[model samples]
Target: MNTLRIQTRDGRRTDISADTLATLTATLRGRLLTEDAPGYDAARRIWNGMIDRKPALIARCLGASDVVAAVNFAREHELLFSIRGAGHNIAGTAVADGGLMIDLIEMQGIRVDPEARRVWVQPGTTWADVDRETQLHGLVVPGGIVSTTGVSGFTLGGGFGWLTRKWGYTVDLLRSVELVTPDGQFLNVTAESHPDLFWALCGGGGNFGVVTGYEFDAKPLGPTVMAGIVFYSFERAVDLLRHFREITGNAPNELACLFAVRTAPAAPFIPEEQHGKLIVGIAMNYAGPLDDAMRYVDQIRNFDAEPIVDLIRPQQFMEHQKFLDAGQPYGRNYYWKSDFFDRIDDELIDVAVDHWAQITSPLSSSLIMHLGGAGQARPLDSTAVGFRNTEFVFNMQSAWDGDAGSEEHIGWARAMFDAVHPYSGGSSYINFQTEDEGDERVRQSYPAEIYERLVEVKDRYDPTNMFCFNKNIQPSAAVLRRQRADTSPVSD
Candidate 1:
């Protein structure tokens, strides 16, 4: 493979020798793919259609040592590097342009300790893998709504999911992480060890290091849960959405709901006439008893008309998790923006409905997730996750078939965000960010003090910023000055 020699984006020729490539390949038990490999195209593909970058090489890491060797090789050769977990990042940062990619897809290992109620999962594993493993003991950890999302990116960005209200963000359950630093030193990060790194990983995204695995605190949950959708037409959206806001505000922690506005899919439960019509749908998942949970949700039936579908009933956790899977598949052009709101007022509802009526694609949709109970109760500084106390967090997304319709869908998403920006909390969720947003939005994702701390940590761990593909935190000059002034030494 001639060490995958290539020209950089700035037109500089860089080279790695054939012997170095052989040494790198032998470091891992898995395969190292180059341009000549048959799986190169499949390995480079990500979840979004908008991302099209071809890496010089893709190293499928089998274990921790493989990750360390890859990092060291990239640093030594001055090659740009990227890390791939489940390859589901909407921003498409998982793959780089003409760089070396360390693909963790071969490291799908999960160990569940039922007595301790904890689970250790490797980066390549998906949420569906974790849910299935933990459910055997009637236990589960909080994860994203989409089962395909990677645990590494999801938890790093303070994961919010179907059980957020009851269990808190996915970062809240994170007990420890195994990471390889930019300098290729491996460290186990947790509250008791490398506490600063632990804080930075919670919501800082994958800016600091390549996390190989995560140890999470799992909770005792159900083999069965009460969940399903309650669909309503767009005509009653304003009233029904406002009513939903009021109810979730006072609802118990075990109850969680999401308000989605999209064209109704052709499901057996929905009438065929409404297949392409815009509708306001409530996706509910309650972890408590079925009869009591239904009591609080029965008020939804009192709307002006009968719902197009009411599938709320007792079902297994896996069944409810799989319900939303069919709508979201791989290789679609996706654009998403997220923010938090203190309330869903009539003004905000009006803005949402207007955008809903003009939706340009079937896959386009918006989500308003309630943030109360367990989610709101966390201390602001308990972890690096910012905007924890907001009343609700909402995400706006636009998905379409191909590039022909991209501009129209992207324009609508931006307009919808602008209309509701005034009502939104200043910060945004890190996982939903787009590449065009630049550095400012990344800074806002964390609190000011926490962001400063993250920069200091960046100076200590990744001083050269080898992992600059993510939402970066550049070390400040002041931090360097403080480090010089203080003669205290720390160990890795």
Candidate 2:
């Protein structure tokens, strides 16, 4: 093969000569895929159907060393590059157009130290992998409702889930990270060793570098827990929400719940008459003892005005983690808008219902994730993830099948987001950022002091802005100028 042409970091044409490419390929244990290589297309596919980026090359990294080599290659050539774990990220930023993609899907390895109560995982590992291992030891790591979501992106972007109320955000439980810096050096970062890098990596997307491994402090919980759902007609949504507000005001930390307004799916549990009809659902998971969690089941049912179906029962924790899988399957076009609130009062409730009435597709949903307890007990500055005071995290999620008429679905989601924006905390969630959201949205997501600190870290590790595909935090102008001044003239 001739020299492989590619785009550089500065958006210009470049080439990795055949010999260079062969040498690079030999240095790694994994395959280096070019545009025409077998499995290249499949390797580039992500969970979101909307993103259709075709990278110039794909690095199918099988392990940590492969990631290191790929990072080094991209840096040495100044090639524009991206990193992919499970490719389940909502924004689909893992694959870049005409750039190098470091695919880590083959690196999905997990190790649990039941004695030490810690779990070490590779970036490509999904939450289900961790849950399966940890739950076997009668313990759990706080993760998302969907089992298939990748652990690295979620944790790095400040994850929240059923156990979030008890164990705090996923970043809170993170003990250390094994990252390959922009310069292609392996670093074992922790609070005690590389505090600055550690702090930034906690919730700071993949802005600094590519993380190969993550270690988190696991919590002892369950192989089984009390978890279920309650359904009600859309007419009673307001009433149910009002009652929910009262419960959330004083609900126990062990109990985590989510309130969603959407058209009910035609599941056997749902009455055939109510299929495809609008309804309000409360998805609850009680990590505490079944005997104790039993008391709150009826209490939750009472919140609904005219209860339609109550599937609340005790089931395996793993099954509970997989509950939302049906609602969010692969290959769906997904656009999300999100915000946090100190409370979910009538004003927000009305706006949510009003928007739910405009849902363009049956797959779309309006949801409010109840957040409190340990996630809020800690101070805001303690971690890179902010929004400590938020009691409810609201999301307008739009998902649909096929490409035809997708524009209108996206427009509907954006409109609903606009209506609910005024009631928000004037900030956005980094994880929920869509491709349309710009740099300003990124800056406002963090506090002034925090954003500046993140900039400082960016300057120190990735001064040239190599990792700009994510929710990027650009290096300050002063740092760029300093680098220029520090540069020595070459006169060999």
Top model number, lDDT: 2
Clashing pairs in 2: none
lDDT of 1 by residue, 289-384 (tens): 777787767865556777888887889887788787766778988888777888888888888888777878888988888877787787987888
Q: Give candidate 1 misplaced runs (Cα > 4 Å).
A: 6-13, 477-492
Residue 34 lDDT (model 1): 87
Give me the displacement of residue 481 in model 1, in angstroms: 11
Q: Which stretch of 10 consecutive residues in model 2 shows the poorest summed lDDT?
A: 298-307
lDDT of 1: 0.83
What is the C-alpha lDDT profile of model 2 across 87-160, one tens digit per residue? 99778889889999998988988999999999999988999999999999998999998999999889888899
Q: By TM-score, who's the top model here?
A: 2
lDDT of 2 at 114: 94
